[model samples]
Target: MNTIEKQKLSVLIITLNEELYIKSLLKDLDFADEIIVIDSYSNDKTTAIVESFKNVKLIQNTFEDFTTQRNFALEKASNNWILFIDADEKLSPELKSEIINTINNPNPASAYLVYRTFMFKNTKLRFSGWQTDKIFRLFDKLKCKYTTEKLVHEKLEIKGEIAVLKNKLIHYSYTNFDDYKAKMKRYGMLKAREKFKKGHQPSFIMMLLHPIYTFLYQFIIRLGFLDHTNGIIICYLNAYSVFIRYKELKKITSSRI
Candidate 1:
């Protein structure tokens, strides 16, 4: 652990067949006192590559729900403050510097929410719903951990204030249109199940109207138009995702009842 004015810091990342981006992140965050990688038994060279890094601590767990997986990763962390990174995401140089400075200056706040800039292909996506996608990825371990229930997009429950960082965590969420669609199918299904179990019912009117509203909201109101063709594609796909979720929820409900 590097000596600093503040408490020790831990970094945690979740992965499954993510051999591509994991190494770069570990290299960049070499200052982390502990780097815990909770992998879902990746069959690829992910484990082999990760083992090559002296600083990384790799643990294999069976594929489980995302909430459980994240909570498990949280348990493996060994420091007071944790910086959560996804296997596919990388901490920008500016963000890396900011993280060090923030911890050294340890605020009373329980956590810090960082901004994310998603890149598709070689282009940096500046519009659509992803523009303002901020997440609470840095936190004091004692003060917070992930919620144990929500599966797909789990969030932490914290009681203290949250500080914001200016630098962004670069998210390589989409490699191409095909990747985006495939992810949408998986995520939409998960979201639908959650919503269904929570007793959220969307009427026929809502199904018809909401998707359109969402498209306009993201592309027009959110100014996704500024991004050109990518913006339009994003809005359409996101709206389509909503429709798929609703449709899948209906299927789940019908089968159960």
Candidate 2:
């Protein structure tokens, strides 16, 4: 009897009270050889749901900056081939096939940039500065890891060759208008804290201009206006987030002084 070996893939996902979406995402990652979830002691049924899945291995750690949490996940991954995805992100059938083929190739890139389609409450955002959204998802664990010292947007440092995949990874991050606003505010707060750590002083000129520039950049320059009301709403929210970040930064700086 001859058996063909399948390429080993270890999927890593970081979570925090993601009971609402993680179960469905875990189901989609069933094809992976191993699925490791680094949860931040979620006070929800997220762990319960994950435990129900036979293939998933759940580990709890206290919540911290995004980079620290993601790096922790990377340390827990067993296989060298890693596919890092969020609880709100999922792979389409075509993307799943492509990833399998890529992993099986003898000479694949050290890491790959996967395009992400942003969805806002069931609407696919074709604009609002999200059209070119991409991230390094699939990669060789030995060759790549998170590097940027940010508390919000964790960036990966990749070594050797990099390539882009054809299929887009679906992102169901924001569920509704309120959900978007809540997330924006939280991200803004985290970003402000990161800036404060870097000794970024509060500037009145930046406070006034950054948000305005952000609105213009998103709405006018990025063609977000063409996406109509949805785009308009996101652009406004994005600008508001910038305002919130500066506002929080001022508070943090004042308290320190």
Candidate 3:
């Protein structure tokens, strides 16, 4: 066992009915000094499971945009060093060790980006544009914050230099096809709402070609065909998600006009 130098690190997570993956995620996060979960009133065993952990603190809030929920979590954290992780994500042993070492030895950078390896139905995906998946997860709360521009795919904005970690974060993104479709639909709606609010007008060209282009780019250009059935399904669903978003945007625009 490696004796890591103690560092005050707060692990922050935002959840909404994520009972399936919450327990396992929390278990792997035992190394954190405090685990703060900002839930959107999940009517499931999510809260109960989190309560089982001694170091975890759960706060229930109404469902809002991703940026708002994440920023709220940041304010609730006691420590300066914050690691924002989703319920479906678990820290690999290598990542855990790397995080501990990084925090112990202070760096001039305000945040660190970690790569993620996505799993679909328990199979790790190597292609389909998932190989280069990375996000800024670990950061100093005072120096970094999520941008409010994107309602669905919110990204952290750092004030100073950004460092990259070597190890990958394990992400169990989808259990089955149904789960994947459901999330894509939900995200599409959220993205459409954001665009509508920004006064984006839907064009017939975009509605017609965007989905087709998206499918071809991911499946053919990105080598999504390498994953076989999983790749095809994911690429098709992704294209479907784009179509749904634009369709909803058109509806909203038509109603306004």
Candidate 4:
């Protein structure tokens, strides 16, 4: 069944230095009526590769913030509904089926949340915090907006009810431990900056307890242990990032005080 004939939708992606993953992602998403790729001046072959695709509409936009980039991409798309996907992720076969089904029959829900299956190295870390991670990827273009202030972990602002899509978005997040740590460091800085700007204060208890709780929640209770060593590392690094964020926030707040 040609889902495009029933519901018009655009597959929008905002990318920066994503040459390795873009082609694979685009290959499976041929069902999209339009493909809008907003690139942030990648010195890599991203633009060249995107041009190779017949349907892709590429735009070079400087990366400022996630909200600005995504909103800018939305403006470029002609479709009324949009499916936002990351360059590092691809729609699983099951997810492709779900998307086709959803497009064939528009659900009453305004937005749809899809789970992501995150892979670390050679293993699929199902027990870690990533396993149950769900994000709102499909929504009406006019009804959603990414938060401008909170740049990282930016979520769409939707007014109506959200529905869940059964299949998962395959996320090949970390190539190695170093890659994971590097990302955490970058994300921690952004998160800390956001907290400092908000005038939020972290107590001693929070600074010490939050990371401990996070590690336990993800590794033990969340069954992150099932993934064995990799799971433990993922959970540990994730909690460590939290600790670093609060530590940075505390220092920033203290200096201001």
Candidate 5:
């Protein structure tokens, strides 16, 4: 479908120090009628790269919770149809075409879930829980909004019907193990903070069992071994993240007591 025939779409993105990936993502989003970037005052060239895009409107907001930042971006959207994508993620050509078709057709659903394929260190992981990583990113602003339940792993709340897309969103999450580990640490800390805010008290058993279960569930149950070395590393890293999160939670809870 051509641009004129398709419903107007606003592509919303929240970024913080995403200079390395913002340019490429902006390039891929040229098909959208409007691109709204709500940046958290990235100290790098992220703002500059976003400013270069004519279709994109750059808005700087203080770093807050993910849900708040995303909802703020949604309000700035002129189109009712909103596609919220991360800075590290790019829409595949197939997915882009599918989105256009879906918008043009205007289904009764309020939101669409898109599967994501992760790339780590130049390897596209097909297994190891990554294959099952699908998120509801494309939605109608009037019918959907992000939930404020969790700080790190926030979810979209849809008031109406939902549909799933076939094509995958390409996610270039980490360039190397070091980068991945850094992200895991940050996420772990954020998760711990979220748990603390919810008055969650971590026990020794949870700190021990959660990581073990995480490793076994992903590496064995989820067939992480199928992806070979990368899968193993990812599973181990995920377990480590769980362990760190619980440990941090314990420390925070202890200090409070």
Candidate 6:
């Protein structure tokens, strides 16, 4: 269906140096009433590619934590209903249809959780703790905003009821191994800062054990091994991120003394 036939909904996204996937993802939003891209002042072709889509509004802001950027988008949205999506995410036809119908419901939910089929750089992993990945992507902007505890993950604070959609969003996968590693490292740094702000300190034992537990939990309990090689890599990366988080926290605290 064309955009005009769909309900008035603003699709929001926060991006940073996502030139590779921006074009294709934008193309898929043809059914959205309005598309708004909030960029973190990328030094790449991200903004240029976004401008190519005249219908989509491109706004650049200095890089900040995830919650801040997302809340900023809420204020910029003209429509009461908004769908927050990532640059690396795509909506299947079925999922798009479900969203349209849900919004048009006589008494629909205030927010909705959309599950994802996460791809690890072109390869889809069935297990590895990714199978249950879900996000609150659709919501009423008037009733929801991201909580302030943001650095690693941004969570929505909803005032009303939330529901889940059956169809899944396609996570377009990461850039590459090295790129993903850098991404994880960045997240770890942010996480450490956030924890420090909360008056939390990392112990030597916690730092040492957290990563080990992370690896074991995902790889064993979550069945990352079932996914074979890629799953193992993902589990390792997750574990490393935990270790880095603690390591950064320790550094931040020690410097204060």
Estimate the TM-score of every prediction.
0.90, 0.94, 0.94, 0.86, 0.92, 0.95
Which candidate has the highest TM-score of all? 6
* lDDT for 57 (candidate 2): 95
- lDDT (10s digit) by residue, model 5, range 1-257: 64555589999999988988999899988689999999999999999999988778999999667777888898899999999999999888888988888887845479998888899867899888988899888888889888877777778888988899989898999787887888887788878988998888998999999999999999988999998888889999898899989999989988888
**Residues 128-218 of candidate 1: C-alpha lDDT, one tens digit per residue:** 8788999989888788877755768887888777889889988988777877887787777887878887887756776778789989999
List clashing residue pairs in candidate 3: none
Give lDDT: candidate 2, residue 92.
96
Q: What are the per-residue Cα lDDT tens digits for candidate 6 across 99-193?
A: 88998887878899999998888888899899899989999888888888876578888898999999999996666888788888889998999
TM-score of 1: 0.90
lDDT of each: 0.83, 0.90, 0.88, 0.83, 0.88, 0.89
Residue 228, candidate 6: alpha-carbon lDDT: 92
Residue 149's lDDT in candidate 6: 82
Instruction: Sort all candidates by TM-score, best to worst.
Output: 6, 3, 2, 5, 1, 4
lDDT of 1 at 162: 82
Q: For residue 61, give model 1's deviation from the true position in Å.
A: 2.2
The reply for model 4, stretches above 4 Å from the true place, is: 1-5, 202-208, 247-257
Worst 10 residues of 2 by lDDT: 2-11
The clash count for each model shown is 0, 0, 0, 0, 0, 0
Error of 5 at 59 (Å): 1.4
What lDDT tens digits, residue by residue, belong to model 3 across residues 1-257?
97755668999999988999999899888789999999999998999998988788999988778888888888899999999999999887889989988888744468998899989978998888888999889888889888888888887888988999999998999798888898888888888988997889898899889999999999989999999999999998889899889999988888888
- In candidate 4, clashing pairs total 0
